[model samples]
Target: MNMNVAERQGDCHSQLLSSHNARDLLNSVDAFLFDCDGVIWKGDTLIDGVSQTLDMLRSKGKKLVFVTNNSTKSRRQYAKKFQSLGISVSEDEIFCSSFAAAMFLKVNNFPREKKVYVIGEEGILEELQLAGFTGLGGPEDGKKTVQLKPNCLFEHDKTVGAVVVGLDQYINYYKLQYGTLCIRENLGCLFIATNQDAVGHMTDLQEWPGAGCMVAAICGSTQKEPIVVGKPSTFLMDFLQQKFQISCSKMCMVGDRLDTDVLFGKNAGCKTLLVFSGVTSHSTLHDPSNSIEPDYCTNKLSDILELLGP
Candidate 1:
């Protein structure tokens, strides 16, 4: 633990969830919320002892809920990945930005006549389709491009009323051109993004541009910000509370990012545990400029087992 963090929240901040008061903290929370990409696994590899820690927690009758800002995979797909990784998670145990995006449109009473122009992946498209929304401009278009010649014209679907952006690995100038035109040309057009994370760690040492990068491009051109539905929004937290009938006070959010995960937990009135296995480093947390802080901090997910006992 850093001296600065200790001073801000004191040495007894949430009891540190250490061996001294781990039992009390564990007993207090009925459920544990997790952020997937950083906390559990890094890319296709599972972090050491993550499965064991989760299993141990589950054995104690604690409910596990995964809240992720990743809009690339739908809940079903996420479940499949969990099975492959030996995590034993169900579809209901997962909530993602893709599902949140679909729910947002549904709750807003989006017209059936209007379709969504997707700047994302198959997961987002599947969610939209399941939500009874027709989506356009996905990987189905392949690498198609339109020439901006003097006498050339670009054709767009007139019925696309909402432009939904997510983590699209196949992002291109053509997609950006079309997405920009849709928001600029259409009246009452809705622009939305799954998250605004600038960069996502592809691996322990490699980083890739996230959805926010592409969303920023569109925003720059259209001068319109999107209605984000991912972490730190509190919409998903509200959705989970309503869906699972769980109280915010009885939950703890564990993640590796301070801005999204810690801030989300803070906004939702839940205890937050920060792990130093991903984006944030100890020095980063120690920085005075950093505003977001978690109730407890540890080296990794497995460290929680110290409180669980042998």
Candidate 2:
């Protein structure tokens, strides 16, 4: 799954544009949604010229929003990171997986008396709180342990109506045991995940187990799949559309990954752009097994600047 761009060489869609034709592609959309990490930054470092490219897009009167599947940070925290990188993004312009999970529950009319049992981190908890939902069972008691056996009942929280999973650095038998119990024992306990990305991007150029790894453990234990709220799911797009009243025809999704970012754009009826500065490689795009394709492909996000007329 981790093919290098050079190794995965193949023809992309016919929509591929050069510097000359790039301007026309840019003219086709009024709004732009970007993925963080691979697309904008690599860990704590911002991608070269990313700030200028975003500024250029904003100056062109294009609406911009940062969409990330990483549930480790809240919108406020994400905004702080943008500011730290000299990119002026407001919290309102950010939509992360944590927010999407919270919104999904809210729209479903999740019970006010019921609380969500979280297996993630503070970001998820904060987002749930911001959406007026109660979350428990995260780092507050991550160290708490309980021995559970097969088909054995343990005293559990009766108010837990949902089991939401994302990335948890402290994920242990305790969290997994409780999460499985909530899904197996509790009636109508909704299962949700931020993303299914197996390998997360890191600055060290090493692959780390993503949120999907944790979600997989729970799935294996409970024999249930979670409703993912991140990329490739139109839930976030639907939320953005309803909240911003923006038309998909005027929107474009730009990112480095294909399965999530490109598929997400395709699902939401937005133009998709794939940049090689991240996880996806040209060969991976060419892989016949890969069904997702972007409207355009470039070496890096900065390549799109060529579309910006002088």
Candidate 3:
């Protein structure tokens, strides 16, 4: 998931910034957090200026962290994709909702004996696996989603540890109720969420509530707070700051979404760069309903390179 920062283009100077200006900002940053979907790639195609911006930043000795609200793929998967796009990145430089979740699990003593009862796609499953944990699927009681079904968490696997919540295209009332009950029983099995995005239904106007909805169900039902492993949370920023040794002040968060990316940067007290390559557009900037604002806005990532003053 990415945050939207509505665009209001600045008047960039006609002349490119000197090496000093470029390095000045580079020197000011301690870390850099970027959203992957709109700012970097849309589908399998990489956006313009992404490679050059990254290269320029890298050449300036800036530390970069690719932050995405997407929890569907593992770090390895992301790294491979970036490599395929001819962009150089390491798994260490990537952080997703799943990464935050794995860190939370390890910090809390999960998978030692607790198994996750997953309610999301395979991405969360892979994340749990890398964290030295195993999970089970909900009971196949001949239940079909997008319609009707009975509660299933009661049918939790004997080795179930926590109820893992991810993205589910075919969610139904039964899944929600069952998941709520699982947390209620105090199996001590926790509720872990990959990412709590409101844009789960981007492909469809229905705007289906994502795992965050399920998380709300569990929290409402059991009054138990599940750890959120995504942007807008300080964990991802902390991870970047710690891993990259970038000073928080010199860092910037860049993304197309305002809620996830820009808000996330604001929370971390870092500079924010909003791009309109995807998801969000300039119209959103003037809309009061959109309760977010970024420090900078650009039509494309390339504009950032364009704005570097001498």
Candidate 4:
């Protein structure tokens, strides 16, 4: 029988792996999409029992994909991090917003002769290069300052075709000015945002300003919205579906954030699991004003094994 909206909410509210049919739920999904920063590791630290749980899942023949909205690291860099943490993740198994941004440009047939103006770090630049695109302005322009004197002339590259914005630790007036000119003045210059997450775990201690801050700066100056290529956009989901040839119904998304991770899975028509080891708390999930809900809730990812194992 079909349950009403209230009943459904009630059911989901009580659907923690500890009390639910976890073994059946785990058996139903062929693949799992994981959000990295909070769900897998906080900063450089790995979550407890994560390695054992992942090994158990692999033993059961389940595929795993690490889908992260962090644009600060390329797939190769992510793989290295995984290795350093003793997690057996491959480069192809990782999907980051940096790679998504580059893939968006490539699949859209961006002009090869033109350059991409970067507002982020080496991650975006590396992905752009790997995608056969030249990237300009990043750490190289971090120390550059603008002269506010009267009649000061600022010369920006005319060959710039698109301005890609991500999480830039060294965000400054010069880079923003350059990006604004390209988008506002350059004909047909595309503005692309890796992700618009409001906050991120830049460190394990606290949340910091995310890529949205940088994207918003360019958006305000250009008076234009960017093509978001990360989670909640379904771009990465589409890419993953094609690359993995997996059906959305047979996949489960596990993450820590409701706005991005859970919402992304819901948008992509997959089962969603919310965990509390990251940015969100249990009270935040049950707040009266909160609308987004996942199919399941757990204290941590390792609960899949601890709660379900015999």
Candidate 5:
């Protein structure tokens, strides 16, 4: 019964002609954009065939780029991790949301040389500092502007260039309230967030809150929509095109999530390929009418190689 149901539901890929067609089309693809975390590897372990398939794609002369929302590490660190995984990737090939955020602020004229109050994690804070945004109320000056607690608000610093939000494992009420106030006081205060992945890596579905969660809370309090520059934001795409001279027409975003990965490609005017090896598993690939569909779907990256046509 399960076999029959699975076949009936997912036979789109099983169809011999459709499978051949997708492979042929994918072979013609030039630039391949990948999403990390769920798409390439779930948590720490490498997803099977990932390394080999990427190598294969590279051998086929297709340009590769790994675009991720995970800002916990820099591009250099991510490249090292991929190298450690036997997947050869250069630092220039990786694009993280944190990097994009910093670049976005820099490009958008985010008030250079300002002491900014941050309500995010180390990754974000590091990028802000690199971009010249100083930390306010941090322990450096032995200052304590706001106490950590639920529904707490920190005193505002006049020099906040923007209220940037990312994955905060140690978030509290004070951070949320103060961050929102920064946006509310001036709707033009420049709001930014990482990504909107609600749940991640766990059983019993103990989904952790995403940056979008904080953005939502702040938006609820401030009536301001964040300048989302993550997946589907086109900021990264813009960065890529400007850096590499790759046309948007020849780019393809190959990821595993429908909401983020696929939507990113669709919004950025790139082809979207949904691989079942990551976040949105086979079961979640149902209800086609539910919105957020990819241009092509495959069970594995290796399967994409065959699409290169005979």
Candidate 6:
């Protein structure tokens, strides 16, 4: 018997995975959607037993798709990171929010003549270029300072059709001004956000402000909410579904973020497994105020291997 979302959440909210159920879950899913930062690694350091667990899953013929909300890197950059961590992953197996932002524009038939104004990093620019769109005002405007004079005219590119915001390490007033001008001044200009994660593991030592901060700056100036293309939106999920010819029921989303990762899985009708190796904590998961819950909870991704035995 199949259960509704509410019923399923109520029945197995944060249910710890054991050998019996681990084997059952393993056999039930044909694909796994993983959030990179928390589930597979934290910052630059790969999680212990991750490569082995991924190998085990691959050995079972489960399709692996690394879906990340981090927009700081392109698919190629992510592939390099995977290689550095000693995990074999192809660029095709990675789906990042930066790539999703570019895909959203392409799939929507955005005019090729108009360019995109970026308020993020090179990742956004790279993806936009790969999608055959020109991107302006990323790190190029990082050192630019706008001097406000009495009659000074603040001019921006009129050909910009969209403003894409992501995790920008070099965020500055100049980029924000350019992006805001494009969104607010340009007619019918689209405001697109990669993700709205509040915080992320920017470095191995600690968390840092995420793309939401950059998006919020633009939102504050333009007074327009952006169309999010990342997790919890199902935009990427739809793309993945069509590309892989897989149903949501046959995939499991593994991550450490409840708001983005787990909620994304639930929204997409996929099974969710939350690991406590990143942003989320045990108390936070069980908090009464927390409505979103994963179908299963484990200490880490490798716990599946331990639970399943040899």
Angstrom error at residue 135, model 4: 0.4
The candidate 4 region of ten consecutive residues with least summed lDDT is 5-14
TM-score computed on alpha carbons, candidate 6: 0.95
lDDT (Cα, 0-100) at 235 in candidate 6: 94
- Model 4 over residues 1-310: C-alpha lDDT tens digits? 8656555445345367663567877889999999998899988889898998899999989999999999999999999999999988999999999999999999999999999999999999999999999999988899999999999999999999999999999999999999999999999999999999988889888899999999999999999999999887899988888889999999999999998999999998999999898999977787655788888888898989897765
Q: List the residue pairs that clash in candidate 1.
A: none
Instruction: Put the candidates in TM-score order, highest first.
Output: 6, 4, 1, 2, 5, 3
Off by over 4 Å in 6: 1-12
Q: Which residue pairs collide, candidate 2? A: 5-281, 8-282, 8-283, 9-283
Q: What's the TM-score of each model vs. the native?
A: 0.94, 0.92, 0.78, 0.95, 0.82, 0.95
Candidate 4: where are CA atoms >4 Å away?
Answer: 1-14
- lDDT against the true structure, per candidate, is 0.86, 0.86, 0.70, 0.91, 0.70, 0.92
What are the candidates' C-alpha RMSDs? Answer: 2.9, 3.6, 6.2, 3.2, 4.9, 4.0
Q: Compose the digit string of candidate 6's lDDT tens values, residues 1-310.
A: 8656555445446788888888888999999999999889889999889999999999999999999999989999999999999999999999999999999999999999999999988888999999999999888888889888798788999999999999999998888889988998899999999999999999888999999999998999999999999998899998789889999999999999999999999999999999999999987887666899898899999999888878
Give candidate 1 misplaced runs (Cα > 4 Å): 1-17
lDDT of 5 by residue, 1-310 (tens): 3455545566443232256676665556688999877667766667776887787778878889999887556676788889887788898898988777788888877777654555555566666677666654222222223666798645676567577776665666667666777777744577787776665542222346666666677777877777787887778888898878877768888887788888899888887778876667666666534367677777767675555534
How would you encode candidate 2's per-residue C-alpha lDDT over 226-295 as one tens digit per residue? 9999998988987788767889978999988888899899998998888888888876777767778888
What is the lDDT for 25 in model 6? 89
Higher-lDDT candidate of 1 and 3: 1
Backbone clashes, candidate 6: 0
Model 5 poorest 10 in a row by lDDT:
136-145
Best-to-worst ranking by lDDT: 6, 4, 1, 2, 5, 3
Best by lDDT: 6
Q: What pairs collide in candidate 4?
A: none
Candidate 5 error regions (>4 Å): 1-19, 135-154, 202-207, 305-310
Q: List the candidate 2 regions with Cα displacement exceeding 4 Å.
A: 1-11, 147-153, 307-309
